[model samples]
Target: MSSTRFTDALTRLVDALPEPDDFPSTARNRELTARVGTWLGACFLLAFLTGVWSHLAQLPDPVLPLPTRPVWLYRVTQGVHVAAGTAAVPLLLVKLWSVFPQLFRRPPAVRRAQVLDAAERLSVLVLVSSASFQLVSGLANSAQWYPWSFSFRATHFAIGWVAMGALLVHVAVKLPVIRTAWLEPQGQPAQGTVSRRTVLGVTWAAAAVAVVTTAASGVPGVRRLSVLATRTGTGPGGIPVNKTAAAAGVARAAADPAFALVVAWGDTERRLSRADLEAMPQTTATLPIACVEGWSASGVWGGVRVADLVDLVGAPTGSAVLVESLQRVGASSRSRLPGNVAADREAILALTLAGEPLSLDHGYPCRVIAPNRPGALQTKWVSRLEVRP
Candidate 1:
């Protein structure tokens, strides 16, 4: 069928169905529900737009330089993306409560009943499922736990498409209800007429407040005020590591002779020593430490670049660099060496933080810093380096 015919048929099918009066609630509830639906729709739309932009920014060699986009802009957009999604939780609950009663009202069969019913059911399922997953997964990712092996970015990207498609179908199906409710005040016996404009204004104001507050507390620039900052050492998997330890480790490593700071790549069987690293030319860069937890701090790091170190050893391009931590247990020494280092070109066995020597918590002897990767990937307390192909 032509697009116009399909839309016309769909609209007629929806129009032929029972109206709000056919359900159990008063007119007031219907109006309130419609108003809430509008708010939720607005939030969803904002989230969808920002989410697409953020994901597009991750594309390699994008038309625009996304990283160079002012850090504040990134923070605001990301904050909105998260805030809109969080607000949807309560809005969806209210919307579902208001509309659920309509499900019980039966209507006569119309043209393409099977197709319409199937399409409606499928759309609802996708909408609910995708929204639920995105909200839950986003919360988990923010907490820094990967429940699924799949990359969060990839899953988020795919589910965003599903959510958008489902949203379109839902809007198409509910067009009549939205129009009627929007045009006329909700008239009910118990509750007087509700001004649509008032409802919309209040909802928009609430959403704005939510977004602003959340962003202020959680984004990098304003994160100092966040309650979460006060609760340190509480990362996922009971990882005792915290920002304090991370900062201290980097400081202590530089001054302590026992601390070994170097990047090594090659067979784990053959270990590289501190002498080996000193022989290579070192480069220092003041890079900001950006973490997924919405915290960011700049640190001055000094180390032989993994690429340079690998070249000194004559290792292949694809060889993995191993980093070691000074912390040891029993006979075995603790280290992050021999890990995959080939993934980044600027990976470094950092020896300094913010121009000072490493602190105890910050990987005193040495730590690995690979730009654009998670903090966990940057191992602390360097002791050994091994290259692997």
Candidate 2:
């Protein structure tokens, strides 16, 4: 069949189904849709910006070096990322419900209008599908649940661009309608149970509740209010661990009496036993293990400064280091520390937490704890540090 004829047939089939008129509701007006959409867009923008920063922060060679001061920068950004994403869940549901009837909208009779309608429908499909996947998968990641085989980080990052693009297109197409809804007052109230104001108020409340309940994953101050928090902010040394020695297959190796941290640069090498490292200068830094999964807790970490370790191997200041873990598996088994980060006095191969010897689950032998670094890159169960100038 010809393209026009095919379009007409599909339109007829869709029009035959229930129309928007059949699902009348006062909350289904353009004004309410616009308002909900505005809030949802703001959430998406915030999530996208922070997600980009997070992805960059995790890269072996970040596009830009992330900040290393204030100590709690990543903690705040990641916290906001998770909280905004969590809030989007409820806002998305309400936005979809407000415009659910649009799915049954009939194609226009004119070919020109029909083409525009088809384009709008396509944009909406992309927007909804991408937005839904991002929010749902993000929640799963925050909860540490992985039901899919694909890499969440890579997939989420790529789809984020698509979602943002679709969102921009949608806003451009609906700008006139949105502007009208925002500037003009609503006309006579529709004959329905809930008012537009009621729907909007309820949606805002739901979003707020969602954020408050889950924000403890990152913000410890809100832990009491966050009953639904993913992590309780309680673990070894008063900090949560994403991976334990048992889970990472490093339990026996970490406890071995002969265990030593090998620091190497070129032909020079030094193997320092646990006691030997303790004898060296100890520096304590209060740093937050700000997880990308959206939880964090601060602890007083004491250990040999990473700068000192590299210095033993004849490496000069501003030299980067590759930290290897006893972890035989997983992407976090080894991580690269940039030069500036390695030179930071606050960067240490921590041996003690809260003035107590490190727990096995908390990297007994040693772990890299640096300011403003993602928790995953902290390199727990540290076994080797290869310095590079």
lDDT of 2 at 384: 92
- Model 2, span 165-274: residue lDDT tens: 99999999999999999999577485767888788889999999999988755555678889899878889899988988998999999999999889999989899999
**Clashing residue pairs in candidate 2 (N, C-alpha, C atoms within 3 angstroms):** 217-295
lDDT of each: 0.59, 0.90
Model 2 whole-model lDDT (C-alpha atoms): 0.90
Give the lowest summed-lDDT range of ten residues in model 2.
Answer: 214-223
Q: Who wins the TM-score comparison? A: 2
